[model samples]
Target: MAIWNSRFKKSFDKSALKFSSSIDIDGKLFNEDIDGSKAHVKMLMKQKIVSTSDGNSILKALEEIRNEISNGKLKFDWQKEDIHSLIEERLVEKIGERGKRLHTARSRNDQIALDERLYLRNEIKNLLKLISDFQKVLQKCLDALPEQWNMCVKLKYLTEKSGEEICQELNIAPTNYWQIVHRAKLQLRNCVENNWFKN
Candidate 1:
């Protein structure tokens, strides 16, 4: 029976367990789940909720589990329902009674939500780094061009200002604006082909 089965009179149906299980979706979040648990254990120690010796033991075991998973030495049992329960089970197996105290003031809903937020926070940091790198490349492309063409490219493509807005700001007519932008595009095309796509 699952860890929470004591609340029910009989064992839950296998089909119901399979249908309600979130292991498939939440398995990939193992790292986030472990990190959150580590934080929770530390807080429990701070508030005198769990003894320091137990907290230390839990942290040590969590680190071992993380390394085991990373090195392909650990395979989680998907039948456990979700990553949270899986980690808790493994922790208990490692440290006996201390593992049970890791969940003192936390709930499944809050744990899952915290893991998802941590995952998204990491993804956002990666995307921001990628954007910053692309911007540097774009600046290099613009800097290699003539002064007028560079300004037109920055205003039109980089700043994303409309033709009318750029023309008004640059004190140029609409027709003149299009002509400059057209020439700038052609120059950029050639520049990219020669510098970025050379055969």
Candidate 2:
């Protein structure tokens, strides 16, 4: 049954339930949802909002649900309005009455926000990792260059020096400087394609 079922005189239409449901989309938020719930449950316990025993039961069941979802032993149902309701429904089934207490002090709406923020945080961390890996690959390509080419590339690109300035600093003719830069770029592109992008 839907959480708001009590307010209605008639049962919800199956098609409308399917139409209004976000389980297909927010089902991706299982990890964030479980993590946020676990933290919320702990906070409730600490503040004496729920008994420690009930909190422990809810936490244990939540981890079990997480593992079940991770191992594909559990499947999400489309009947639930969203991931929060689906998870809470599973929680209630696992631990009976105590699982209901897991929702204390916060609404499912709050869980939705928390899960989204956590998902974004995890995505940002992953993005940072990709950026870090790209920098490492660039450094490897840079390190493979001939010493003079490395210096010319760095002066021309890293320090934003003009072509004339880089040639003067490296004591190379302007024509030679351009050739060095061209070769360096080709090597960098080939190295990156072979080492990173090819895969």
Candidate 3:
């Protein structure tokens, strides 16, 4: 099964059309990727897997690489297997044996999973903030009208529509759509009832 899955793994066959070769698609995550490296380094230090000096050196090298990549001084090779391998290779070149120790006990699977979880956690927080801002906008729209003119039913309809729009925009799965909408509706209700627009 693993072999079959690997067979179907995605490939990047085309060169990045960005300014620099290294400024490719993966370059967009340079910050997050560096942050992940920092976290991994801290974990390695805590586990005593690598000495403090080595860890610090690895971090410094990563920062320099990040700056180089950011400034377009670095160029990515299309033939390289993947980003992690490419990074490991660069580290080895920069810091010798100590750089080689960075990947000890770490699997590509776990590394990719950690990076994805970190990204999704951040995305979810941003989405929640967007939802809150949307609710605030709706509350303001409600406040501009008199209390008697404040149509709960109209507001409810708009809220439902907004939820539907969000589900559609996010491509939310049918199974999860209702739950997400329910939560959004509850948030809208709270915003409306609390007179959140008073401020």
Candidate 4:
């Protein structure tokens, strides 16, 4: 029986249940769900919505469940409609009545939204960091160029133009073009070795 089956007289049809299930879409939210539940339980305790003893038990069980999932000791059940239900079921199994109290103040909509926001906020932070690092590398590579060599390096590698194409674009003769390309390559190589790839 579902954790929410109390109001319904009969179980949902299997096909209907699968259609409404969010387990597949929200499966990646296991950790976020546990985190949100823990925060809710903590708030419940602070607000006296639930006793400290019950709150402590719920948090401990959640931590254990998180570890179990991380270590592959627990496998999520796809039959559960979503991570919220799966975790609530596990919590109840672990600490019985205390586990049921974790959801005291929040609806499923609020809980899921909080978890998703937390997850997306963390992901956005990581993406920003990656983009910042990439920008730094690009700056370092560009700064490595000698003032006069900068144009040649940018043309040859940054813009991905061949030596002959760069010469044509820059209106330089082949002889001078090859010389600039050679010096630019050497400068870029040393710069990368020093600024990026060195020990």
Each model's C-alpha lDDT?
0.84, 0.90, 0.65, 0.81
lDDT of 3 by residue, 1-199 (tens): 1112256557433443222233245545556666787788888998998899999999999998888777878666544434565676778789998987766777767777776777788989999997898777776755654442344324346565554555565566645656544555565566665654454
- Runs in model 4 with CA error above 4 Å? 1-9, 140-199
Each prediction's TM-score versus the true structure = 0.70, 0.75, 0.57, 0.69
Please identify model 2 stretches exceeding 4 Å from their true place: 1-25, 123-126, 171-176, 197-199
Residue 73, model 4: lDDT of 85
Give lDDT tens digits, candidate 2, residues 1-199: 6788799999888999888888889889999999999999999999999999999999999999999989988787888788788888899999998998887889868888899999999999999999999999999999999999999988888897899988888899999999999999999999999888976
- Candidate 4, residues 1-199, lDDT tens digits: the string is 4556688988888887777778778878888999888888888889999888888999999999998878878776767777888888888999998887877778878988998998898989999997787668657777867655678777776686788887787788889887877887787677667765653
Candidate with best lDDT: 2
* Model 1 per-residue lDDT tens digits across residues 77-117: 65788778887888888889888888899987888899999
Q: How close is candidate 1 to the true structure, as a TM-score?
A: 0.70
Could you arrange the candidates by TM-score from highest to lowest?
2, 1, 4, 3
The model with the greater TM-score, 1 or 2, is: 2
For model 3, how many clashes? 0
> How does model 1 fare in lDDT?
0.84
User: Where does candidate 3 have its weakest 10-residue lDDT segment?
Assistant: 15-24
Candidate 4 versus truth, CA RMSD in Å, comes to 5.7
